[model samples]
Target: MSSAEGNLTWEPATRHTELLAGPVARAIAATPSARVAPIDAELADTAAFCAAYDVAMESSANCVVVAGKRGGEVRYAAVLVLASMRADINGAVRRHLDVRKISFAPMDQAVELTGMEFGGITPIGLPADWPVLVDEAVVAAGDVVIGSGIRGSKVLVPASELATLATAEVLPLSL
Candidate 1:
């Protein structure tokens, strides 16, 4: 993966946060090419981080947690889309999950289940059974910035590497 630019310092993602030290870290480590950079927690939001770090918005990706119920069973998913587009949660996600309805996960539930902060939820450390829907546009972008499972840092990795995740599915998930 390409190195992050601006005032950030690149390092193994595992070293940045406890959230990234488990399966998240393992996934990145297995890639052999991923890199993560530490940033001020205050700038973790996509817009602020991109502006402060001099990174283009198109180079960043957002991971959103979605929840849906089917046959009285609740299921969760993490949807990765470029900052430039919105995830089609109502259509694409609902259909993919085979549920009658779907919506953005509640902040408390998401944070609790994923062990991530409200805005720092990344696809990396999510529950193994949760599907990670990656937008085709994001996968085509090559190098992209993503959450580090914590607000204190961000990960720079190849979109292709994210596609390799067992729970990840690259598709037209954006509207």
Candidate 2:
């Protein structure tokens, strides 16, 4: 367990405006050796945030939570992707979750169930049972940047370390 920054008090979104610290942050805490890193909270989206910070997409991990129903079974899945790629929710996710179909979760529904601000959600800290999928390429980038459980804060850690921290399963699933 190796942590990057010791305890840094960065301000996570305090309201429902842009981001909030939730599952992702909790995962950071769960990481035996990870520390939450600071990120500007007013980010519009992952691409914008990476461009503004000069963070390489390959090194930036993005978490997308998707929901859908198949054969009358409703399910939610979180896909951790590289900033350079997209989460192929339609195919890979549909197959992995074993859902006949899948789609991006609606805003209101995403917030209600995730208990997170819209754009700040992360796979970490999600209910223990939710399947979190990580792209193998993303795991190889090392020192990846990801949501801080809040829109404003992000956690920075070695990619390998992140995988270890989350017990994440890696596959070639990113689009």
On lDDT, the leading prediction is 1
Residue-wise lDDT of candidate 1 within 1-175, one digit each (tens)?
Answer: 2323555666665455453534466555645556677778898898899989877778889999999998899989999999989989999889998988789999999888987777777888678899999999999987888887778778887889889887999989889
Compared with the true structure, model 1 gives a TM-score of 0.90
lDDT of 1: 0.81
Residue pairs with colliding backbones in model 1 are none
Q: Pairs clashing in candidate 2?
A: 20-150, 21-149, 21-150, 22-149, 41-152, 143-159
Output the lDDT of residue 109, model 1: 93
User: After best superposition, candidate 1 residue 170: deviation in angstroms?
Assistant: 0.6
Deviation from native of the Cα of residue 8 in model 2, angstroms: 12
User: Can you give the TM-score per candidate against the true fold?
Assistant: 0.90, 0.79
